[model samples]
Target: IANDNPYKYQRRLASITSATVAELDVAIPDPGLTTAVAVTVSDPIDVENGAMFSVFQAACDHEFAKLIRHKDLRRYHSWYQMKLREALMADQRDETIQNGYMQDSDEWGLPLGEVEY
Candidate 1:
C-alpha cells in the first residue's frame, strides 16, 4: 500500500547520526534490510486535520462492524457511513469552490467562456 501511494502518507527521511554496531542492530530490528544507516519512515496521518481521515476511519468502522453480530453496532455503523458520505460531499464542495476562485483570478488569465478566439 505504501508503494502504491507514497505521497498519501507523510514520509520522514532520517539518518542514524551516532550508534554503535550493536546499538544499530537493536535500533533497526527489521531483518529485511541489509543496512540501517538511513531510513524513511511513514508517519501517521493527522486525522483531525482533514475530512478524508474521518471518511477513512468511518469506512473502516463500517467494514469491521460486518465481522461482528450486534444490533446497536450495526446502527452505529450506518450512522458513521452516512456521516462519512456527508463529509466527502463537503470536501468536494470546498475543492470546487477553491478551484473556482483559482480560475477566476487574473493570474490564471480569463475564464474559459471569456477567452477570445
Candidate 2:
C-alpha cells in the first residue's frame, strides 16, 4: 500500500511516558481556603493530546445525543461547552511549551507579562 492511503499506514503508538502532572493548586478566596492536589495517570491511553481531547468531545457528543430525550440535557451541554473551551485553551497553551513548539521568553516575539490569579 502506498503512503497516499493514510489508513493503510495507521499504527498504534505507546502512551506518552514523559508526561507527568506538573502541579495542582486550588484556592478559595472567599473563605481563604487553599489546597494542592496531585493528579496522576498510571496507564494513560496511547494517543496524542489531541486524541485525548477528542475523547472529551465524544463524551460531549454522547451527552448531546441524550439531550434529544431530556430537555435539561441542553443545560449540561452548555456547561460542558464552556468547560471544554477552557480545557482546550489551557491545553493548547501548555502543549506549546511542553512539546517544545515554543522557545523561552527570549525566543518568543512577544514580551512576557506577569500572570495574575
Candidate 3:
C-alpha cells in the first residue's frame, strides 16, 4: 500500500479543528481498498480556510520568502500569518496563566529577595 501524504493529513486535522467536516463541506469518502485519501470540499469557505492555513503553515516552515514573492497572494498570506501568530500567542498566554507562570499585579503574592553570598 502506498503511504498517505502527510501534508494531506495535516490539512485535514487543521480543518477539523477550525471547522467541522460538514461546515467545511468536506465529503466523507466511502471506505475502499485504498489506505490513503485526501479530505477536501467543494465549498468556497472550506477551500479558502484550508488554503489559508496551508499557506500560513508553509510560511512558518521557512517558505516566507517564496510566499511573499507572490504579489497577488501576499495580502492574504500576511493576514493568515498574523492571525495564526495572534492565536498562538493567546493560547500561550492562557496556558501560562493556567499553569501559574503568570500573575497579574493584584495576584502577586510577594517580591523576590536578593541573596548575598
Candidate 4:
C-alpha cells in the first residue's frame, strides 16, 4: 500500500477477488445474472469481438456447485485452464493488452500503439 503506482488499488482488488474465488465452496444461485442461448452452433465460435466472455460467465454460473470429487475438480480446473488460454489468444498470439492499472473505461485496455503510456 506504500507504492504510488495507479494500479495498486486495482491489483489489490483483483488479488482479493481471486482469493475469494479460490476459497469459495458455496455456490449461491444468482437469477439476475442468468442468461440463455436461443440456439446452439455446431460451427466454431469466433470470439474476436469479446463475445466469449458472456458465454464463460453463463457456463460458470450454470455449472456452479457446492462440492465435487477431487478428480472432478481437477478435471474442471484443467478444462477451464485450456479454455481460458484460448480466450486470451487470437491470431495465433496473445491478444491481451497490457494497459496497466487503468480504472477508467476510456483508459482501460488502451493499446500502446494507439497512445503513449
Model 4, global lDDT? 0.38
Q: Rank all candidate structures by their TM-score, best first, as comma-separated numbers.
A: 1, 2, 4, 3
Clashing pairs in 4: none
| Candidate 1 pairs with clashing backbones | none
Model 1 ranges with Cα > 4 A deviation: 1-48, 93-117
Superposed model 3: Cα runs more than 4 Å off: 1-68, 92-117
lDDT of 1: 0.48
State every prediction's TM-score relative to the real structure.
0.36, 0.28, 0.22, 0.27
Give residue 22's lDDT in candidate 2 (0 to 100): 32
Q: Each model's C-alpha lDDT?
A: 0.48, 0.43, 0.41, 0.38
Best by TM-score: 1
- Answer with 1 or 3, whichever has the higher TM-score: 1
Model 1 shows how many backbone clashes? 0
Question: Model 4: per-residue lDDT, tens digit, 1-89?
Answer: 23333321111111225522321233325544223312222323434455366447534643562143343454454454445444544
Candidate 4: stretches off by over 4 Å: 1-71, 91-117
For residues 6-52, write the lDDT of model 3, one tens digit per residue: 33322122334443332223433543612344543323343234545
Model 2 C-alpha lDDT per residue in residues 1-117, reported as the tens digit of each score: 234334312223334354542322332234322224322333344545664566476556747657566655545555544444455456665554423223354544232221111
lDDT winner: 1
Candidate 2 minimal-lDDT segment of 10 residues: 108-117
Using TM-score as the yardstick, the better of models 1 and 2 is 1
